[model samples]
Target chain A: MSVIAFAKNWNGKFKNSTFELVSYTKALANQLNTNMVVLSIGEVAEEELKLLGNYGADKVLTVSNPQLNTLTSRAYADIVAKAANSVEAEVIVLSDNNSGKAIAPRVSVKLKAGHVAAVQELPLSLDPFVVKKSVFSGKAFGHIQIKSDKKILTIAKNCFGLVANPCDVAIEEFALDIDTNLFKVKIIQEEEQKDKVILSDADIVVSAGRGMRSPENWTPVEELAEVLGAATACSRPVSDEGWRGHEEHVGQTGKVIAPNLYIAAGISGAIQHVAGISRSKCIVAINTDPEAPIFSVADYGIVGDVMDVLPRLTKALRNSKS
Target chain B: MKILVCISNVPDTTTKVKFKEGDSLFDDSGVQWIINPWDELALTRAMELKEDAGNSVNEICVIHVGGASADATLRKALAIGADKAVRIDACPADAYHVAGQIAEYLKENPFDIILSGIESSDYNGSSVGAMIAEFMDYPGISSVTSVNLDDDDIQINRAIPGGKQVLKTEAPFVAVVQKGIATEPRIPSMRGIMMARKKPLEVKPAVELEVLTESIKFELPQEKGACKMIDSESAEQLVELLKNEAKVL
Candidate 1:
């Protein structure tokens, strides 16, 4: 039996999340007394593929079919199932990102494997194969037991940090018959956002809320983010008011982020809003009302008008950096 | 073309979550129920599509796999302008079971378009839509922000890692929608509420399926320490604290 880790890459390069996934898979493999195999789809350089070795991957299987360039969930699931069957994999692991969320369920359906998404930690007991995950938008936790023999799981981002365990990795090319009928959805256009820190991957995030007063008063928030080399986010009200793009909204219905440091200004902490960022390691809240709900979960609190506090904080950070 | 929107009954967003029964069951004493936020947006977008004269969407139906307590939530969907509602009478055991029941129902009653939220606010599983699509062998598009019909063709825009991608697909597909599918969820009007009373809300028996996962325990996150308050006049001190004390800088 083996553990399969699905590694995702962009433009032929692995991201930090891929390293974390490999590390988690390696640890799980050790617990199961099995080897770990990392699966790579589409085109990635051989040199780039070898990097998985640094994270304790015993073997790397690359499927470089040009037809698999674009992400078709059905086709991807089929390929992953075939890889699992070839290696006799007992567990399949993936990151709980957009692609993983879309594909893991389909893979589970194909393999008849019991699946769990956004799993937080390793198995609490190997006998019953129980794992823990956040539920109710982070308000509560649920310990779920996978009853089926075959298991599929998607790890929440940032929950498991990267651990390097260098090994001699065997790289192999995996070839599978293509079914052209699976490619039903056609891509009409693609647009990539350029030159900004992606919020989900940022280490630090500076976010504002209605306390910034208006859309034009966003200069201080943006300046602070620029100085810190962090991403800019907003509360739902700010996005609903059209002060920021919907993508910048960080809350229950918006993007859920787990940055190392999260700074909130002028935003009253609503439960829904806090649910999204509750995973942040450290949170600093700046609000005029000292009794704001955000302060309860915050590590640090400053009571002041945001318009007055933001500029001063930005200046202080900028000066310290210089 | 008929459009089917899947909805889940969940606690209101503002309700404080608590579990009872030795942390094995959710306490529902004072909690208010509402349609899952993402599913509400999906239903709102469906109503918008049906309102347009150019589109062939003549009927919009909403479906839920839950017990009878969720009938009110289904009625709320009808009040929001869904023409029909279907409730598979059973406890939603898990994502797999819920998806299987819906897929079994769909085998006999098919629709051109099926829309489900990315995840239910309660479990946040984000699996049922794609699983349903897989069970039925239909194309499933996730993270969808917009769905439009242009002269009998469907166009969808979905959010990707750094940007967005636009795709085109035919009918008999599942689109797991998220925010931006509609600017705001529609509030039920007085007339709409009265009409919803007469709309068909069919209750069907759930198909037997094996439950794959079980929740053995529930836990609330540990309480955070009291916030370290800093004087407003000493804004620089906050930065120093972050650098030296918190060590996050």
Candidate 2:
């Protein structure tokens, strides 16, 4: 049986998260000595689809349907389940993001596969098929054993690196066996952020917390992100106070982010907040309080006012770029 | 409108996690048990919707897949505003098993709307809500921030990576809500507490599940090392360190 990885598409292009899934799934499939197949949903250009081979996909299945462009959980799950069955997949892989977390369970239930979410590493033993996952809101790790022949695993964002390993990819067209009534819930509105790095796709993120004070002070944060070509995020309280939109919130209940470099300005790290970014490669904390909890997790910390440090950091980045 | 809200009894968020017996068992010796925060948020939202529906909404039933150990949490839910409670007499082994048990219960007693947290704080699996919807062959929506009842249709908004999207669906739907679904969870008052004692707390045996996953061991995350502290005034020096020393820049 083959291994399947579903690659999500948005704005007529594959999401960057798919690459990470492909890289890791390829490694996993190799461990099982199976073929690595990627299922790309929605409209994707053939040339862009061919790039999947460079990321280690042995074959790419593109499901091109105008009606399937938008994300409706039921319809998407149906298509994924059908694809997995067609391939007779033993394992299905997805990134543990909003879309993945939403769809993985439905697909698992449909395929009767054991599902494991927010997995950090690959399988430890192929016999029992054990995997490590974060539990207790990232306070601890648990080794889970999937006792089923079929399994579904969702990797945490940024937990696995996207390493390029070229494979021969044969692109195929997949016609979805969709039920006509699946379009009951239509997406009324979709507001996309154009010309900006997607937060989950970014390698570097500059986040702020309540220490930033108000929404107005967020300008420097944005400016710093702009200079560094990074995405901006906020702590839970910042979003709760209406200082930032809930979409920018990163924590246990919010979006979990892991990037190469995560810089926090005026953010005290709560266990919940730290849990979200625990996988970050490097962390830098900037706050006036020397005893702030963020420092314990930071590789480097500056005990200074965010207002004083932000402008200087932005200016330094601007100078270096110019 | 009939609504079923699913809650889980979890350790308090601040409680330190400890494992015993080769890291296979969660040590609950002195840990304080409370309603899972995420489930509390979902419960509050369900209660608010019931209030808004007024005469149209008849009851808000809270359910849990646990043994007598979870009755306290069920009582707390009743005090918070649930009309009744259902305790499936079983300890949840995993998310799949829990979802299966909840689905088995839901099949017997159908409801118009099924609401639950995105996931329990302890496991952080974030799959039970969607799995239940799938098992029952209902439309399931996750990361939902707001739910507004428009007669038979329910308009919901959910979060994405960098934004949010709005969807409109009819009844017999499942919603997995997050923090923005409710501002705060309701605290049990003295009068409400007294009345909860009289409220119905039904206990039902759990259905057998074809459990698929098992936990083998647990390990704590590595302790972080000493942080490299820099002077507050040395902003340029910090930048130099990020570039040269940390090499992340």
Candidate 3:
């Protein structure tokens, strides 16, 4: 029996969050005095599989199937469950991102294992198998306990930083029966941003809100992000209004981001928006309203229009460097 | 084209969360209950799709797994243009049990399209929709922001990490919707509210399923320290602070 950390495959590569998943899974395996195994599907290079060892994974298992090049929730879940069963995994860990959210529940159901999502910390205790997770959209924390013999967990992305405990990983190939018919949900169109800094992986983020007013006004926001080498993001309303893409949305209804520095401009900081970004190491809010709720949580606040603050900040950043 | 929208009643986002019974239960005194905002997005989009598809779309049924406390929310969904409503007469224990009840109901009355919020506002467990799809052996899409029905197939645009993907799937599928599905949720008109009261809200008994997880305790996150107010005129100083004091640069 081992602690299994399922690596998320996206756009034909492992998501960067896999490191964080392995880091926490290693901690759990250490607590349980067991091995940490890294599981992935589809074809992956040997060097990519070996990278799991840098994060303390003892073994790497891959299911190289051409059929799994595109994600189908049911089939992906089946393969993961089979891998867990093969190892007699005591616990399965996955990052609670897009693919994980779709697959974790089905994997839990297949294994009849108790599952928890958006876990923030390592296990407080394992005798009863207690883990802490965000509840009520990050307003509070719930210490959840799994009553079943098997456990499946989805760690909230970026909260637990990766810790390296390098080991000589033993690699092996695992096979599962694939039903081609299950791939009914066809991904007819997909566009990957190969060069842009992903919001979840960025250390610094410049997020705009409705205060940007129009999509045309996003130039300074993008300029500021470029100046700082940060990723660009927006509040839920901004994304809903089509001012920005939904993938750039950061809020309870969208993506939860925990960056080293999060700068919010013109965002009122609704509880839902704050839920996603409250984990930032330092938050700077720029808004016209002095009483905006975002100021309450911000480490620093600048009372001004986002339109005004953004350009000045960008100019200052540009001038300071030159 | 029968469509089902799943609704979850949650406390208002502004509500200060409280725990009781040795931190084992939620404290609900004087709390305002509202439809899960994301679920409202799902309900509104389903209604719009039904309206757009016209007579081809047969009905829109809203479902929930809760007792009387959720009736008002279900009624709100009906008022927003759901043709009918179904309330499973039990409190949902967890995502799995809730998915089981919905799947059991769908087993008898399968809808062409099942829509739910990507995650519930309270627990934020994004499992029920996928679990339901798995239980029913149907195609499921998550974080879906756009949906269009063409004959028996549904074209869905779902959010990925750096972009969105357009997926094509046949009917008898499930979609977990998020913010971009609709700009603003529909508000119930006076006539709609009046009609909603008479709409069928069939209360069905919940299926028996063992809850796999239990909440041992709940606690509020630590309060943040006071914000340091920076003069709006001193934007350059703030940049300097970021570089030197905060060291985020």
Candidate 4:
């Protein structure tokens, strides 16, 4: 009859996505009126888990072991499942992020819990654990109910705002008998894309596409992001040509994003790309093709060659900043 | 290198997204279907692994969990050179249900390698592969960008927060393939297309897992305001408009 959340750890430093996730989950905790426990797995420090109090966690449940440093599907899932069972938690939440996406269902299956992914809102009903989630690539919302003893949820990024609290909570570390052999796969090293914003977490995003013509012309798009402090994204076709990294691709086939503002330049918004980002609060489309599908959904649409339009816009933003 | 790749039939990337009239059901009127674009990456990578293994790669089997519409996608995989295909002839609404069907099928025939798309473009749930891997008790890695097999061991280049990680595992594992891993998925050659005609395609009914969620309604987002134009003469004017008008930054 309690709620618990898992806060993500990226390297030694906290990831912005993790903080956003914790902040948002607190909203759900407040609505439920249940004790909230925030847990950080593996060797993440005790002090780190305590930070969850500010994000709405009533208590911090941490398990520290050197063996937990490398994340394996089996090991991580085992720890999470064990913790939930021991605590008899009614609800469990995690970021609908890389590791969470991979392990959430497995944990749900183990707990015999009803699971919901891509959640954008708190529950309208506590019993049956009914919650609202975006489905069909954000084309609609599905009301999901958990028909089991526990419910698992993967909350979408930036969907809920985090509110900071002043109270501090103490951390309680648990000893887990983890079996590393169960993890059939092992990671040697992880490499991240540079000069790009993660589409899933970007608050304001600027995207380009084949309309930019080639990789050489991507500078203007990058410049706009720099000035706006926005993330860089692309249409599927751009990623196909290697003009941009795969991480930047935003479409039904790449990533689903719901940023505060999405600025698409030199990109003809395909239906698939639109499906992915249509949930953005505001979209500004800049393209030379007046009839581009992008204009159909844009808050502000401009018909002009990006080669000329982007430079002017970048210059405008820079001059304004100075 | 016995490879297993999962595929889903999805609306073509360019297909307009609109639900059926008066309901949350998808509108199929003008919607053309294709192999989920993401699944194409998984299928191609599996075929490549089977090629590299040669004799060691006994077979490359394709699997699908859907209604009859999924058959076309399975044949498309066969056209791309999979030796055989399976269709769990049930329409699934949840990841757990679909994963259950695929997992049950795999239990009968253990594969050395399981490949799947990072996410299905239609539902875009992105959870089936991991559930299948867990059900079958195999090591699983999702969103793998590049893969290489050396001496019965697989090395994966995985996308991560700061950079990509190099992951290594033995055969009998699972990976959800992502885009940008290969050139456009190879269209089946005419010969392969012809041979696909004779390949084995087994169809089984989908398992019934209890439905957990129901759709109340599908609402299209609110329309945006019309475009505001800025004359191109002065950058200062454009900046003034952005700062004072659009207020995006």
Candidate 5:
């Protein structure tokens, strides 16, 4: 039996999340006394694939079908399921992102494997194959056990940091016939966000809410984010009022992020909002209300008006850097 | 055209999470149940489409895989504008099991369009929609923000990592929707609520399926310590703390 780790790429370049996944599955493979094989689909250069070996992949299996460039859930699942069956994989792992959420379940159905998503830790017990995951939108944790011999798990973002364990790695091509008929959904157009830090992958995030008062007063927030190289986020009300795009809403219903540092300005910490940012390594909250719920979870609290505080903070950071 | 919206009965968003049975199960005592927020939005969008005369949508049905207690949630869905309700009589064991039960039902009773939330607020698995699509061999779209029906073709807009993706597909598909699907969920009117009680709520036995995962225990996240207050005038001090004390900068 072997372990399979699905590696994802964007324009043939692997990101930090893919490296973290490979490192995580490598540790799991070691614990199980087995070899870990990294699987890549679509286009990725040989040297870029070899970088996965630095994180402990015993071998890399890749399928370079140009038709596979765009993700079709059914076709990707079919390829992953076939790869798992070929190696008689006991465990299959994928990142708990959009693609993984779409494809992992289908793979589980194909393999008849017990599946878990957003798993936060390695198995607690090998005998029962138990792992821990967040439930209730990170309000609590659940220890889940997979009963099937074949198991599929999607690792949560930023849960397991990257670790390098270089080793001799072999690359092999996995051949599969392209079946374009399964591509039922046809993409008509694509709009890619340019020259901005993706919220899910950002290490530091600077966010605000209605306390900024209006959308026009967002210059300070954007200036601070630009100075710190952080992504900007907003509360639900901010998005609901059309002050910011819905994509910038970070909360239980929106994006659940676990950045290294999260700075909230002028936002009253609602339970739903707190649920999303509670995983950040450090939280700094600034609000006029001393009793705001956000202060309770924050590592540092500042009681002041956001308009006054934001510019001051931005100036301070700029001065400190200069 | 027929539309099936999958609903999940979850605790209210403000409900404090607690577990009973030696931490093996969620403690439901005094916990008010409501339709999963995302599912409610999906149902709201379906209702909107059905209300538009230009669309061919005729029937709107809601389905849930749970025990009898979830019937109230289904009624709530009906009151919010579903034409009928279905309750597969069984406890939802896991995502795989729930998707399987729904897939089995659809095999015998197929709908033109199937809608589900991107993830349930409770378990937050984000799996059942695609799994159902796979099981039924239908196209599945995730992170869908807006779904429109132009004649018989379905146009969908979804949020990708950096930007948005626009796609087109036919009927007999699953669209897993998120926040922007509907601006707001509709509240049930007095007349609608009265009529919901008389609406058809068919209960069917669950098909046999293998249970894949089991929960062994549940625990709350660790409590954070008291916040270290920083003087508002001294903004630079906070930056120093971030660089020296927190080491995040």
Candidate 6:
């Protein structure tokens, strides 16, 4: 049984998600004692495909054609399903990005496999392919198993560290003659947020809620995030009030994120919002309200004005490195 | 453009989750249900499109796969201005079951475009929408922020990691929307609330479900550790405690 990973020839450059996914797929494949095959769809440049080897992929299955290049869920699913069937792949790994979220379930249905999206950890059991994932946003953890032979999983971005495994893997072009009838929808356009790290994959996220009280006060939050080289996020209320863009909103109804380090400023950790980001490895909450729910989950709780605390923390970190 | 939007009835955002007598079922006592947060996108976008097309969006048919208490959520959709609504009348406890029921209903009526939330709040299994599209063999995009319907194609602005994509798809496609799709789903106005009463509320028998998950038992989460506070006076003391007690620097 082979392990298949889906990479892409995205906009002429290798998408970070693809590289990251292949890294995790390599880890999982190693654990299962199986060979890894990375599927790079569409007219992907050969140069871009070479990065797969650096990212731990063994054999890259390049399906470069004009029919692809757009986000066709069914087309990719049909191709992946056909490839996995041919290779007798027991597991298919995908990035939990937009394309992965769109295609994982559909492919699972085609293969009649157990499907899990937004998976946060590598498999604890290879026999059953059991993995851990966030549930109820990030409020809790659920361990699930892919009972079927063909298991489809969308790994949460950055769940595994990017290891630079040096290898010269072969890039073999394999084509799946999938029928066009498979795609119910053909994408005309795709949307992306402006010039910022996707919060879902950010290593460090500095977020603020209503306690900073005004949209004008967002500068400090942004400043702290800038200092830490972290993505900036906000509470649901902050987004609702337009202090930040909705894409910057990180909470239950907002984006479900599991960044490495999440710094929350002036935000109370409501269960709903906490349900989204509670999976962060290290959480530092800065708030004047000791009674705020944010303090409940914080690994480090600083009870002071976020405006006052952010600059100090940012300065301290900068100073220490100096 | 006739739109059929699917919404789920879920426990409100702040509901303290608890297990019932055996942890197999969620405790229903004092549980306040609201329209699933994700499904709000489907409902609102349908309403907005209905308005934009010079009222060409004839009917915004809202549906759910659940029980009686779900009517409140149904009315919330109606109050938000859906022309009519239907509940599959089944508690679809599994991903396949809900997809099966929705696909069955969708088979009867071919909608121009179907919208649902990317995923529901409670289950957090985002399988239903894609499953429905897969079952019905319909084309779909997800996390769409802007959908501009052109002559034969639908120009959709789908949200990705860094920015948005201005992609287009033909008619009869499906889209699972995120929060950015609509003007933050309007809190039902008094007029809309009154009109919702007069709107059609049809309840059908629930479709038979094949439950795959066996809930062994429900248990409350481990209670949080007691709050540990250090003297607020000096940063040096706090830093010392953080490194030693908290084991984080």
The lDDT leader among the candidates is: 5
What is every candidate's C-alpha DockQ against the true complex, given to 2 decimals?
Answer: 0.82, 0.74, 0.73, 0.55, 0.86, 0.38
**Residues A54-164, model 6: lDDT tens digits:** 988768887778778776787887788777887788888888877887888788777777777778778867764577766556554566656666788888876776777
TM-score of chain B of each: 0.98, 0.97, 0.94, 0.93, 0.99, 0.87
Pairs that clash in candidate 5: none
Off by over 4 Å in 4: A193-199, B20-24, B53-55, B206-208, B214-216, B233-248
State TM-scores per candidate. Answer: 0.98, 0.96, 0.95, 0.93, 0.99, 0.88
Correct interface contacts retained, every candidate: 0.81, 0.81, 0.86, 0.60, 0.84, 0.35
**What Cα-based lDDT does every candidate model obtain?**
0.92, 0.87, 0.87, 0.77, 0.93, 0.76
**Residue A106 in model 5: lDDT:** 94
Per-residue CA lDDT of candidate 4, range B164-191, in tens? 7888887778787887666678899999
lDDT of 4 by residue, A73-187 (tens): 6778888888887777788888888888887878876776767788887786876477777766765566666666678888887777677764677788867777858866676
- Selected candidate, larger TM-score, 2 vs 6: 2
Q: What lDDT tens digits, residue by residue, belong to model 6 across residues B95-158? A: 7678778888888877888888888887677877887888887887877777766545567877
- Give one digit per residue, the lDDT tens place, for model 5 in A218-319: 999998899999999999999999999989999999899999999999999999999888889999999999999999999999999989988899999999
Per-residue CA lDDT of model 2 for B1-249, tens digit only, reads 999999989998777899999888889999999998888988888888888843367789999998898899999999998999999898788888899998998899999889989888898889999999899989888888898886776789987766788888877889998878998789989998999999999999988888889888999999888888877777677778878887888
Worst 10 residues of 1 chain A by lDDT: A65-74
- 4 or 6: which has the higher lDDT? 4
What's the residue-level lDDT of A297 in candidate 5? 96
lDDT of 5 by residue, B18-94 (tens): 89889888999999999999999999999999999999999999999999999889999998889999999999999
Off by over 4 Å in 2: B53-55
Worst 10 residues of 4 chain A by lDDT: A8-17
- Candidate 1 chain B lowest-lDDT run of ten: B226-235
